[model samples]
Target: MNQSTNPSEASLHAIDYWQVVKNRYGVILLTFLLVFMTALVITYVMPKKYESTAVVQVRQKGTGIQVIPGMADASRYQESSSAMFFPTEFAVIKAQKTLDAAIENLDLVNRWNTDLETVRRTLKGIVDAQDIRGTSLIEIKVRYNDPKDAQKIAKEVAEAYRERRKKLQGDYSNQALDELRKAVIAQEDAVEDKRKLLSQIIRTEGIIYWGDPSVSGGPRGFTKADDAESAAKAYVDLEQEKIQLESQIETLLRYDGPQLMNYASGLSLPDNIIPVLLPQYQEQKRQYEAMKSQGRGERHPMMLSQASNLQSMEKDLVEAVANLRETLKAKLSLAQEQLARLKTRMDVKEDDAVKQGIANQNFVDAKNDFETAQRLLEQLKVKEISETMQTKITEDPIILHEEPMISNVPVSPNVTLNLALGAVVGMIFGIGVAFFLEYLDTSVKSLEDVERYLQVPVLAVIPKDVGVLYKQSGMSPDAEAYRILRTNIEFNRKNPEDNAITVVSGGAGEGKSTTLVNLAYICAQGGYTTLMIDADLRRPRLHTFFDINNSVGLTNYLTTELMLEDVILQTPVDNLYFMPSGILPADAAGILNSRRMSELIQDVKQRFDLVLVDSPPILGVSDASVLASEVDLTMIVVQHRKLPRNMLMRVKQAVENVGGHVIGVVLNNVDVRSDSQYQYYTSYYTYYAPAESQPMPSPVSSQPSQSPQPRAASKKTTSADDSKQDLY
Candidate 1:
């Protein structure tokens, strides 16, 4: 029956984050409210800002075609660098000159009543330009205190940038014309020199070209370089024709006209015999055979003449095809000879051709320069003429793609967004604080907390304000917790007869005495004949509960040769008795640890169905350990969230160290009203009515003049004389 519970064997409880949050919810709520209120106040004081935006298309110049009414149309839609243009455009829109132009055009300096530098700085500060990514459009936005001003500034800035671009392009055009005019004069001088060289070459080298017969000698784009090129082309054509003729003749010479014409234009060649012979010979021979069938003599003239016609016809067809093929061969050989002579002549003129190519190249360069100059001269003259009448205007590369749009609503002090952000931040910070406080707190708060730390089952959860259970007229909800403690003690004790249980705590005012008396009363009501000994000799309260004089009880009985019946008295409750600490003995531990005290505990265990000894906090005195060693079971009574877990373990260790059996624990003074989670401890509240009446003969010493002194007591038997005489 002496079962030992080892602390090492118990599993440590994991600290639940949510449990900590629930326990310290009030602190979290307060922190959250403070943060949220601060954010709200800041939002309330923020100023409103109006914003307007204008969109402009920053196109690569000349990508968009232009329509001019008359004259030759210029090449438009030319491809250029577009991918790299957007970032440059963004910079240009915020340039100092561009912003200055916008300010002057809008008369913003006077309107703002500011100096030019101040106006420019302010405009730049308010302006923001962003190019739409992967696109050529730029958004020019302006923020201001006034909506009208925002809109006006946005529109004026876009127009100013457009005018600036047009002026740049016009200036570039004039500079380009001047450069071209210089090029034309230089080219004219070079062209005259080249013409004189060409005349000298004709006179000195007699380099005149006789036009080629096979070449189509019309004027190509480079007509000046075409003379020798035409002749070379004609000779190439003759050589190609000669090769074709030779291949055709070779195929025809192997063919007989009577055989399959393999090379006869669309026909193919066959065996080296006449194909024409087979049909003519077969026809004549069939005629000869038919005439022989008429019984004509062997020397018949018709048969002989038919045979001869076959032979003659075969010979003529063969000769005709062969003769035609021979004629083509002769013509091909003659053309080949002519091509050979033409190639020889061309090779002899290689020096002349190289010289001619140089002169022609020079002429072409001079001509191209002169032509380009003439075109530019005409365009510049036309531009000058147009400018004299009215300055020519060209389209701007960056134009206003969208009109400026001004919003009616202000964009600042967004209440919903601010509130949402505030809420999220507040919750996170509150949770952090909650966990921090939970970490700092070391009190045991729940059954799990106590069991995990102390490695003992919680016998009961004695709710807060336990006075209501005793004073109320009807059955009270709080009485159920004491009953549960009694039931758990009966069930958990390895030996049911181990009824001498001491209820001890780590510190004074942890409700150890109160819990012991209540549990005894409940047990007595359950027909257990419970006895409560206020071995808390340091501060006797059990007899005070019965209004029995506490000056004569356990101390007197243990310290003197007194009878146990003299100190023990029946309580007002039917089967309950009270034993008070008679007096404070100076040698309290010595008296309590004496063999007489053990005899007394053993005697009461036999007499009462249950004996609950209320001892001083074990940590505060050695007397509680002496009492615990004498009892059958040691039960620690702890105040909820009051005593640190380490102190509770110390209490348990103190009893077990003295060779006492610890049944479990009783978690007393739980605040069930504030935390509904503890309500489960007395879940049968609906079934329990308030106590109809206080137990009969309630204690006369109910009200205390002052709190009892420190739980350690040491005096003598003189203090407990009144209750000792009842034995006589």
Candidate 2:
């Protein structure tokens, strides 16, 4: 017996659940019928309802007037915005105000003979508005007892919602138009102010406009003065020339001869002669150098001629340089006088350009402002006209996609669906209850449950309703369980001397006496000299099984000076004997706790190969505990799924407390057909049963013959034993 739980073993399988269902099928069937009948009754009694629906497409539309252009086209174009938009429309369709309007239009209060508040509430309850998924269409559904009423309510709701939306649009348009008119008036005044400013600039400055200022760059012409940049350019040119001429004149006066001529050659003044003469002087000097290179003296005729020509050219160059200096001086004086006069003209022209520029800027600013204001004013007028035309020819944004129609069929009391739901719910609830009761049931359910709690081996699982075996006509399949119990006891007992075993139970009606009788018969059939002793002093039932006289059994032997042969009786089954509980004792536990009882058990253990003693329920009285202490071993008989696990454990503890060795447990009265876990253990019941073709074994005598006795009680047992045996 392992105290630890094996997870795989502890978990239930599908077969286990099926077994539970089979065992409790009556309870499950009853619950299912109850639920199904309830559903049937409800469906039969429910009121019928008719449904009508109206479908309309709701769209995002603009107000008739747009204060700012293009605002209408920008509304509700995004996918996310459309998602949010439809819910709002649905709410509007189902709004209380809309419902009230529908109610008033249909005259529901007077027609239904209800108050105004009740009519409103009924209309709201009957009407349902929702948007069809992935579309802008809204469905207004109405349900009522009358098909005509349902249809009328749906149609009226749709019309009311449409009219409400249109009214809201109209109100918004009127407000926008008023704001637009104010904007247009303010724009017109702005344009007039700009126009007055422009005219004042034109009259004061005498500037003429060439073309439209808005179309062109700006005001282009200034009639009062020309551009001053021209005068400034001429003054700048002449002043630069004056500075150059003075620089050349200073260079000509500071130098003399060839240096003066070279300086004059570098200066490019107007009509200077030094450029013409310097080349002739340079040619003469080159010839003089050639003659010297020819080895001719300065006084030689050719050299003298070249030298004389160089001197003449040099004197001419100097003369030209001097003349160029005087000419530069003359130009300097002329440029200075012209620069002074032009500076005066440039100042006057700059003053005129400045005045003209100021006037032109004023004109351009005023003209731009005026043109902008005029364009805005014109747009406002166009918008106003467009808005007025739109208001006159207004179209409804809500379009009726489908008209409401009267439905002939009723929508409520769906029999098929209700029956299906009832069946499913009933099945689920029944299974839940089955498992719940199983959880609360702490009885021993399996062989493992007994071994786990009692820490003892399960000797055998006795199939439910096993009767006294020796009296059966032929071999009963149930006899195999006692055979198993016999084999287990033989193997479990360590010493041959420890042969006297008493069978006990936690509570009465647990088949303790039956198990003892069957085990003795099986052992006797297996060729062991087996003895059954009914030691239950409080309730003597073993003598009833054999129809033997209980008046001369154990209590008689323990109380009087009687030999063992006087009480022991041989049953019709060979090698099997019975010791009946002779008489009821006033003090059962006291009678069984004597030294004589211990000696009797030891004496019988030697006489019989196996001795089995039956006792009352150990937890009920002290007689079983007394017997358990006197016997060599105590075997507990536990009815399947009857005694609680803790109570079974207490039975084992009771035996141990009295210094008795517990051989094992016999799990009796199991419903093997329903409990699938034990099917394999007892499947041989049919497999090993004798075939029908075979003749039945000769019937064992149902009555037991008493051993030779001196008392007259044996004669009284003869008549009682003659009757048919009771199958316990």
Candidate 3:
């Protein structure tokens, strides 16, 4: 006995995709048919297109074979080969030159029914060209409505491309040859100028090979320079030797020491006096010094005499050294003079050598230039001859290798592919449209919708147009729905006698009145004294169901001192009673909201087992809200797929805000027969209860259906609710 509203779980269980598909299958089918048919019509009306192709062979024209380094002629000429050439032809096909020729050939402007510009544009769209891979060929394709016309245009395009290509190449060749001839003539002039410069250099500088002398075998210019350097080196050596000799002689003359003895001997003393003089003088000096150190007095006769002998020897030695020094000085003077003269000769020789070397280099460079210019001029002449011959040998770069054929079949209006695309597009669009419609629909369509959106249990499912169901002779399907609603109502309420329930709706024509009339009829048939009141003074309808007058009812009772019995009338159905919406006062709501109305309601509840009041739409009038406040429990009769969820919420809020208890919702007017989403409510219809004539099983023993319908009551006559529902 879980009684709480679990909206999330309810909503989750309610979104059945199969249920949606079943219910919206008709919409999907209709949309698909419409879209598919449209595609077919458009495809049928479109124009057909034919195609023709032509092939042209491109020749690789070049500067006829030459083996020159840095030669650009061959590469430059072959630059117009297929790689760039095919695209150029494609451009040519669309080019004004080529297109103009084709137009004149075919009279395209008149045939296409357009101006020159329009025809050109149209032709551009219809034509295409591509190179044959690994081959020197190109194919030109053109499309037209007529096969013959396609072939004709393609042929004309090939002819136009060929005519223009040859003429352009011829012109290019002439321009290239003219440039080459000018270059050759200019090169010849340069060679002549080079020869003149070489001749001028030979005449000005008497230059030949560098290391060679003049006409004679003996050195004249270069030899003189060589001899000068040699003489200069010899003189410098002699001067250094003389200075060493002079230094030896001077040092010997100054010495009275013993070393002068060795110097005089090694220094090659003269034959007459130097050898003995030096040796004897050394001995005497040594003896004198030795005696002096041994304490011999200076004035001693032997010492004086030895000192005198030493002085004489020293004087002779000094004279000999002086003579040698003077001779060395004379040799030094001669060496200095010779060194200066040789240095001067070396300087003059070097200056002459530097100038002659520069002149020789200039002459060599000019000679090499003359040779190079002569060779280049010869090469240019050969190149010019090869180019002249090339013009005569070159073939057409573009020629038709394969002609276009008249296509037997049109390329467009592919019926199969178009239909397939149409189906895919239609199905995608149809599904989107179906989901979009489902999103826009905000009405409650099923029991799950009511329970989930309103957060309330569905008390009953009153089938759509149930008047016919009740009119049928078999066990009534609709009667059972109302009986289930009754049982649920009795069990859902806390107290059995708390039955002052007002059935209301959020909007008009939601079958809220019908639901109440039928529910009341079923309740009375279930053996309860159910008194019905139409408190909706704005537009009363309960009296219309009872086929009774509403001139004197609840209004009369409330306004005057009338009793409950005065207004309440016995209904034709068993245990059912009726009260009409009597004369409406200017303030019908004022009358309904009075203490008398409250007393009247309570009195009827005490008299009858159940008091069911029918009221106007809760959102439309305040009269229902007032009645709802006075009632014990309020039941909302919501028409399936008629009112929005928000409006139903408003109805529930209207009742509860007035301090009334809501028993539950009655989902009325459901289309169980058509909408598969609601079909589950009537899914048990095939299983019938045993016929009434047979003895029935005891109620305590027999298990009732989860959703049980009413058993047949012994053939009753036409009921009050049935007659009124038929009228509706």
Candidate 4:
């Protein structure tokens, strides 16, 4: 059964913790005072130390040229600086190099009369460095017994760091400048080598170099005399002339007579004769057609003469056309010959151009290389000059803002802070101890502890030092506890006739007898006939409360043939009776376990309304267990916070093992004032106090009276000493 804590249970737990603290307040207070006083004494006796501080602003390292660009550590840059930068700087300030420099500056070896290592160790111990939050400022602090030495050490350390930083920065700058100069010299040599290669190529190739017209002075490609283009143009013209001549010759040969004359007339060749002869042939033919139209016979002389003239003109035209065609053939032959000559000339020029092209390509390549080298040389020269100027510009990285001075007031042994811390720690430690002790103690703390462990209801809670209730005048507030016990016993019993309850404890002095006496008195006052039997033959204590004699009681009756009425005596309190243990018996458990003791219990139950029995601690002996078995009900008297929970459980086990019926437990001697959780159970004491004017009647008579005889006097008669009564 796992239980979760509700708000009510949580509140109960808090109250339980507070109750523990209240109960052990003395231990907590003692622990707290001891710790607090120790801190005070230590603070008072510690030696004083004076502090001197020097303030300086440590700027982040600035951007500088790198011999190898993009290779510098980013932590040196102001924008890229990280949290570790200042811490690293602080470490540098306390480094051995800086401290050695400070020691040498102060001549600490001779002044302190120590060796070099000792002085360095002393300086390291006393010096401290830290950065101001959200700033680049550093504070160098030194502490010593003498204020002047502290001041000197603080100032010298800061100065040493500044000087060392400047020297390092200068060295880095000079190294970078040297690298830049080497780069410039290398670039110059590269440019000169490129120029020499260009000159060599020009001398070998025999090409004309065109100087660059642009401001950058880059290479312009070389040129050569080229006759191949002019030769090719002349050769194409001659070839076209030959094709036209051949076309005219073919036209003259394919055509004849009038068609040939018409086609030859259209030709405009330089050497053709067709245009000169064509017009004469046309006139002759016209004359012939005129004769034929006049109807002249073939034998007529005029017609014959006209035909003869036309035929002669035709022959002259044919002969002239043949001569013109032969001239065109001759002209075509000349054109072909000229074309072949031009081809040979063109080929010769092409060969020369190809040779010049090779030389030009070599010259261009060398010129490009020289131009690239020259450009790089210019850039390097500019960079080198800039770096040379920058090396002379020095800026200090550390600025001393506040010089160190001797402090008059000591800074160590802060009394107020130490005392406050001690108080807080002591209180926490005390609370822890209180809770630890409470955990170890398993005694019954409240009614819950009783019922939860014993599985029995807590019938009542009896306060501490509650004397015999029968002797209290009027109404004592403490009597209410016993009355509540009386009522609980009556209700808890299943049968009203089963009213024989023995009040027993796990150990002696747990207030078992006192609780029995009180409860019996309360029951009598409530008008019930209650009987208290002292069955503890080992150590009888009930007779002491009433100052009654215990010479002849329960023991005498059980050991002899005396009747029960001889032991039972009525007290002065109304309706209350007692039976004391007459003599100390050696075997108390044997006597109490006998059939005679069982009969006495049954006889008393029938005679009285309620019978309360008192016995010794059940754990120590078997007498209480024997008496417990003889009774109808057993009531356990448990002292609060006295017995361990396991022991209480064993007490209940002792009774039940003997066939005794346990009614419930009575939590006796509770201090409700300190344990606030139980206050509510006993809070009505003051409010219910008896008024001075309303005092109740005294239950006991002032003077001794004659003892009344029992109702069953015939069956069990008492001895003749019944008239001698003692009321004191």
Ranking, TM-score, top scorer first: 2, 4, 3, 1
Clashing pairs in 2: 550-582
> TM-score winner among the candidates?
2
Residue 363's lDDT within candidate 1 is: 49
Question: What range of 10 consecutive residues in model 2 has the weakest lDDT sum?
Answer: 719-728
Off by over 4 Å in 3: 1-28, 55-92, 110-114, 129-139, 209-338, 364-386, 399-402, 445-457, 460-484, 500-502, 506-632, 649-662, 668-728
Clashing pairs in 4: none
Q: What ranges in model 4 sit over 4 Å off?
A: 1-51, 60-84, 107-127, 143-149, 213-221, 225-358, 409-417, 438-441, 446-449, 463-474, 535-572, 578-600, 671-728
lDDT of 2 by residue, 44-73 (tens): 898888999999987555523554555344
Instruction: Please give each candidate's TM-score.
Output: 0.59, 0.82, 0.65, 0.75
What overall lDDT goes with each candidate model?
0.71, 0.80, 0.74, 0.81
User: What is the TM-score (0 to 1) of candidate 4?
Assistant: 0.75
Query: Which digits, one per residue and each the tens of the lDDT, describe model 1 over residues 44-152?
Result: 8887778899988865544433323242213322324434456666678889989989998889989989899999888898888997876768899998878899999
lDDT of 1: 0.71
Clashes of each: 26, 1, 1, 0
lDDT tens digits, residue span 1-728, model 4: 23665777888888878899998887788888888888889889988789999999875555544544434545457443565777788889989999999999999999999999988888889999988897779999999988999999999999999999888878886887799889889889989999999999888877556676254464344333346777877888888888888888988888876898899888887666667767776776787788788897878898889788878877877887887888888888888888888899889888877887777777778888899889888877776776666666666878999999989998887888989988987788888887888889899988988999899999999887889877876678998787678778777888766889988999988999989998888776665667889988888999999898999898899999987778888888867788889999888888888999888888887766678999999999999999889999999999988999999999999999999999999999988878897788898875786665885544332222225644221211222122111111
User: lDDT (0-100) at residue 144 of candidate 2?
Assistant: 91
- Worst ten-residue run, lDDT, model 4? 719-728
